[model samples]
Target: MRQLWRFGLEQAKSCIFAVVIFSALAITQFIEISFIHRYDFILIICLLTQLLMLTSKLETWDELKVICVFHLIGLALEIYKVHMGSWSYPEEAMSKVFGVPLYSGFMYASVASYLCQAWRRMDVQLMKWPPTWTVAILSAAIYFNFFTHHYIYDFRWIFKAATILLFFQTIVYFKVNQRTYKMPVVLSFALIGFFIWIAENIATFFGAWQYPGQSETWEIVHFSKISSWLLLVIVSFLIVAMLKHIKGKDNGNYV
Candidate 1:
């Protein structure tokens, strides 16, 4: 147990700024729950814990790009989705619980960081980008999506996949070398997408929420497989393009 706590503490050191921000919000949420509203206390606690996790500094510089782009694309996509009533989560959670509204940012923080840690557990080097083999494996993963639970509920998987390819093509123009495809760096974003996909599937399957069943077909797993590639590719852009720009290290920052 001591070892576990130590490991966890080491992990939470990167996003201290995010944690501080979220903890402040969490206190407000706590007050709202205790004095004003009768909400899901369990879910609120989960949200608070996630926010606390932001105090952890993540040194995955490569993943900075993944977080930046995924947050933009996922936020855009989620806004559109919520607008369309494609699905919904409780809206009263004060926009800060990692589920609806701005808590989405917390969810975004979890993506690349979670993936980086998980990939380290895999103990293998990731293949270089734009290589024939990488493309081949990515293609196979795409194929796997179409046959699974992902597409059954959300076609956004298609959008995710397309963005990944675009991100990769953009990277190709830079002539990125083999070492750029480091394992944790690439997996940082990929794992986040996968977790979102998995959570959505589990929730829908259990009737936590339901997408309109009137859709013409329900192709979940097989549908989302290939689109998974977009995540890794998009991360490349986030690290290679977005973060550099954000940090004033790129030509695009001025624009």
Candidate 2:
């Protein structure tokens, strides 16, 4: 019983930031402020939330750096995606740059924050982690595909195959209470991707962003998006793994 309580507590610790961000989004959907754009308000709330986390020691400096990097990465992708007509931000904001709001980057950073917090709180470890270079190459290919698919053939399935080849044997070890739990790394990616897809639906419902099809009315995001999120989860996982130096052997064993 005590162990379960500790497990729940640690899970909450890991999720608190994401919960707060989602809560803020949910609440802001109903709020009307004539003086300020909703996007700018979200940006302010996100920045303040981040500062509060840092000041309270809920997040460490190293994790902050990782989160910041994701923010930039996400912002770059947002700019390109928005330009490519992949998604649309309907609201106006002073914080907008090339039609991408600053707060949009925080959405990506939130993923990093969640992984970092969970890694530390749950004492995660990797087993048979694929070589960094291999994953890096895969990540680059996946990212490039997002942009090139519009002009060229969509080779996402091929990229997904390569990712499976590279990470199929990898395993992740995390703790629940005093006990350690293990899962295939690929499975972890799929699980996180699934949840992120769900969150994307919720976010879209709240008007965080919209697909071309959603310009007139909100609809459930296509289930096919889970594949994209799976690839992204790998990218985020690699970043966190690199930062933590949790490399493992090629065989399904920890070094």
Candidate 3:
């Protein structure tokens, strides 16, 4: 068991070279002239790269069980939601098995970002008044999530419902700790959001999805992905909240 765990850790702990290459390819596509479809494997590459990077860090690998469960539940929920038009993607960017889009790849990346953040924030203290903090985090995340060049659409009620569901999921997952929680929770979400936004931009260029031509890209610094990171941050929180709930109930880390 220990050997297997160690091996998995190694797999998830590679370098960021793949992520860099993937992003470069993606941005290249978005910039090069012409309108032909571009094939991009950035998200998948990012997923694999993150997995290896994470596996190399056994501490992060410890969250694998939780990560797997989070993806399973999320894929199920998303499949249902997509059918209902709550959200969507390119018709077949993901493999479908048993009437569901195989979203484990995306979920894995999302989970990894949170795991990275949580691991980084482990030593901090939780706050007593987390509401203010949570809201502030939410506001920042929301702003960037929608404002970013990834795929900002104001489906108003659609997003509102999704955000509400995510917020409740947060409550269900995390304990109301008064100390050491703030930094870790917020930072974890922040990093996850960051990667997610980049992943979205990659997808847009790859033909996995696209924004309506009417929309204008929002520029922030040299890194236009800031806004998208904000939304990804929200996703990280939802996943963390769910994991916190499940793990707390079972008194186990993963399975």
Candidate 4:
């Protein structure tokens, strides 16, 4: 029981960036501001929150770089998806480009931030990790599928099968308190994806963005979105894992 409590504490700690961003979303929902658009306000808040995390030493410079990479990657996806009518940012904002608020990228960055913080705080390591080339190819395929699916036949299921086959032997070991715990890498992806799905519901409820179905009235995001999030989480994990591997190899401590 105590170990579970400690684990939860660490997970919450790892979500500091996400929590702050969500809080800003929730708070801005009720307050009216005339000077700045709500999306722009949220963007400013996110920027300040990130600056605080950096200045307080909660996030390192290298980790910030990784988070920035995710931001650009996410922004690109957001632009394409919105163009494809996947979803939309309805409100007007100075920071919007091609109908996506610039702040939207930070949402994706928050996911990377969580992974980076959790990996650090919980002393995470991977076992039976696949080769770099295979992982890179898989990551690229998964990412591009998010775009190409709109034009061509969606290969998500095939990619999902590939992910399972590739990482079937992989295990994640994370430390909690004085005890270390292990779980299958696939299971971790599913769990994180589930929570992110729940967060999506909350974000929509607060009017962060809207699906066509939600434009009339807010409703639960389709549960099927979990699979999408699962795939995304896998890509996020693979990127972070590869970075860890490279760093570890340099430091003579490859996991």
TM-score of each: 0.40, 0.92, 0.43, 0.99
Better-scoring candidate (TM-score), 2 or 3: 2
Could you tell me the lDDT of residue 44 within candidate 2?
89
Per-residue accuracy of model 1 over 1-255 as CA lDDT, tens digit each? 655564455445433434443444446444554543323443354355544443443335455445555566556545555555655554354443334455454345445444444333322232223433444444444434334434465444664555456334332211112122232333445654564566445433432333555233333533353344344334433443333334442544320
Tell me, by TM-score, which candidate is best.
4
Candidate 3 lDDT over residue span 1-54, tens digit each: 655564344334321332454454557456763443222244445456557756
The candidates, ranked best first by TM-score, are 4, 2, 3, 1
> Candidate 3, TM-score vs. the true structure?
0.43
Clashes of each: 37, 0, 29, 0
Model 2, span 1-255: residue lDDT tens: 887888778867877767767777788898888888888988888999899999999999989999999999899999999999899898889999999999999998999998999888888888787777887778778877888889999988898788788888888998886699888888888888999999999999988999999998899999999988987888898878876763333445343
Candidate with the larger lDDT of 1 and 2: 2
Off-target runs (Cα >4 Å) in candidate 2 are 1-9, 246-255
- Cα lDDT over the full model 4: 0.94
Model 3, clash count? 29
**Candidate ranking (lDDT, best to worst):** 4, 2, 3, 1
lDDT of all predictions:
0.43, 0.86, 0.45, 0.94
Pairs with steric clashes in candidate 2: none
lDDT of 2: 0.86
Which candidate leads in lDDT? 4
